[model samples]
Target: MSISGLNTLKKGQHYTAKELDSFISTTDAVLLSNNENQLFTDPEREYKVTHELDGFFEHSEEDAEKHFREKKAYVVEKA
Candidate 1:
């Protein structure tokens, strides 16, 4: 399937189950999870971490660093 088709699925537009299955089968990169004996696919991309932000507010020092890194990586990947 084309990237445009994949984009459509990510947006939650109406599509037949068969179409979704076909697209999933053909994609090189896909997300999947095992649930209750069934394999489910995640259409959204995964997140990653890569930076440090404020070290004194919102969350504990550890958590704040983690979140900042994650958001930075997410932004970079989207770019």
Candidate 2:
């Protein structure tokens, strides 16, 4: 899948172990280090995080379209 654009997830999303590791690679050490020094430490946290990430990864395109459409409508109304 593609990995860039406003539709692409940047942070704050659920992620699989592999996906989380990939994210960790691109993240700052301080942020990760403060989070118990690991990305997938707790199973419960992992589950929740992964679920959120999955939703974003799967629906980001649709979400972006909807977001832009709403923004455009708002701008039109304001003008």
Candidate 3:
């Protein structure tokens, strides 16, 4: 029930709304499991924006149809 890995859910954890809000807003974007093992990063450190994309494609059927109707091309450059 965790969204963006900030424990933004309290389905059974009994977390207060304010507590969840604080964690979601202030805590770093990192994953923490029940085993207390930190994955993908050091919990105390901030991560850098390693990459970015200019645009993305419409994945939904309706959205893709609309995109094609509008004559928008979903282009992907070859690496």
Candidate 4:
């Protein structure tokens, strides 16, 4: 299935950054993973960390950064 953005992104699921970029460009949703998010995550917040719909999210937008800019996964952080 095609995802909308990073927030709506489910945990432990595999997704390509190229695919997500496409979804973000089409909406008002600026990636929450934009490093501007402060809270990151909140139990009371209904908003997902990696919001995929409008491409706009408040916190935890950087959640997808690792996947988007990974040059050497094992070499850098040993995933």
Global CA lDDT of candidate 2, please? 0.30
- Tell how far residue 72 is off in model 2, in angstroms: 32
lDDT, model 2, position 55: 16
A best-first ranking of the candidates according to their TM-score comes to 4, 1, 2, 3
- Indicate the TM-score of model 1: 0.27
lDDT for each residue of candidate 3 in 24-55, tens digit (9 for 90 to 100)? 47543322233233322333332222222333
Determine the backbone clash count of candidate 4.
17
User: In candidate 1, what are the lDDT values of residues 1-79, reduced to their tens digit?
Assistant: 2333452233323333344445556644332222322322333432221222222223556555433222211011110
**Which of 2 and 3 is ahead in lDDT?**
3
Q: All candidates' TM-scores?
A: 0.27, 0.26, 0.23, 0.28
What's the number of clashes in each of the models? 2, 6, 0, 17
Winner of 3 and 4 under TM-score: 4
lDDT of 2 by residue, 9-78 (tens): 3343443444444544564321222244444554234312211122111235645543211110100000
Regions of candidate 1 where Cα sits further than 4 Å from its true position: 1-8, 31-79
Looking at model 2, which ten-residue stretch has the lowest summed lDDT?
Answer: 70-79
